[model samples]
Target: MPSQSAVGSIETKGFPGVLAAADAMVKAGRVTLVGYIRVGSARFNVNIRGSVSEVKTAMAAGIAAVEKTEGATLESWVIIPRPHENVDTILPIHYTPESEIYRQRVEGGGAPLQSLPGNS
Candidate 1:
């Protein structure tokens, strides 16, 4: 565990779901996060840093807790591992065709401007 703090983000759904997930971490140990979660939410980004084990534990617990909530969904890219270190990104970063809608909404990477929702 490095002596410095770490950062992580989880793009999830439901404000209550985010809150519930956060609460679980508090139960596990001391940590911190940001943003508000709610239903049909576009995203949920949280930053938590501590001992490596503690941070990993909190992250797993938080995501698990979020998943337990009804209507709470996690994008495949939701887990941003060691974002500070590009090499630490373990999850596949690509979005499948089935997930294009949600992926575009969250990433805003780019697509035909006219095809985007509300673009018309």
Candidate 2:
């Protein structure tokens, strides 16, 4: 069966903008930062995947971040709810094993990063 997760992409005109979007996206929702795509001409895309609601939340936060970044233009964006299996297989939206850990942590409501005791 096709995955129940949604996929989203936010495009920005510059790297700094895209990076800001990515950081905000992941922080604002329980979504995974799937990957970044360089679309030539200084444009970049930040991909994310998660539940429909989560994807929507992340997209909103990401777009806002891009808007605030200097010299970063919001190019375009899309969010596909329950994308086809073929799309997941062909696109870079699927989560890797490494990213799965993050997904699980978020889903389980675990902290994004664990703090080591007495590290400071």
Candidate 3:
């Protein structure tokens, strides 16, 4: 079935900031870390999926974390509520097998779970 969840993305100037943002996002709210995009020039995007409210909360936390990282800058961000299915197939925002657990937890009405060490 097509997803009804919202998808959010936070672009950062460096990998470390994106990593921190992803960690903060899942910890701060019920969201799934779907994947990321390398936009070249050392820019990267950390993407997440959840309900609109959850995504918004996670995005805020992500931006804050990115801001706190040394030499890392927040480039941009977006949240698409109920994105079209075609977008999932056409874009790199879809969740992978490793991130499926987070999506399941969030959809099951549980708090977001943290990634285990060495899993990413």
Best by TM-score: 2
Residue range 1-120, candidate 3, lDDT tens digits: 235688899999999999999999999988889888899999998889888899999999999999999999999989999889899778888878878766777778434344443545
* lDDT, residue 52, candidate 1: 48
Q: For model 1, give the 10-residue run with minimal summed lDDT.
A: 87-96
Screening candidate 2 with a backbone cut-off below 3 angstroms (N, C-alpha, C), the clashing residue pairs are: none
Q: Put down candidate 2 lDDT per residue, 74-108, tens digits, no spaces.
A: 99999999998888899888888757667777678
Name the Cα RMSD for model 1: 12.4
Q: Name the runs in model 1 displaced over 4 angstroms.
A: 34-41, 76-120
- Candidates' C-alpha lDDT: 0.52, 0.87, 0.86
Compute the lDDT of residue 25 as modeled in candidate 1.
60
Q: 23-43, model 1: which lDDT tens digit per residue?
A: 776456444443333324356
Among the numbered candidates, top lDDT falls to: 2
Q: Candidate 1, residue 19: CA error in Å?
A: 1.1
**Better candidate by TM-score, 1 or 3:** 3
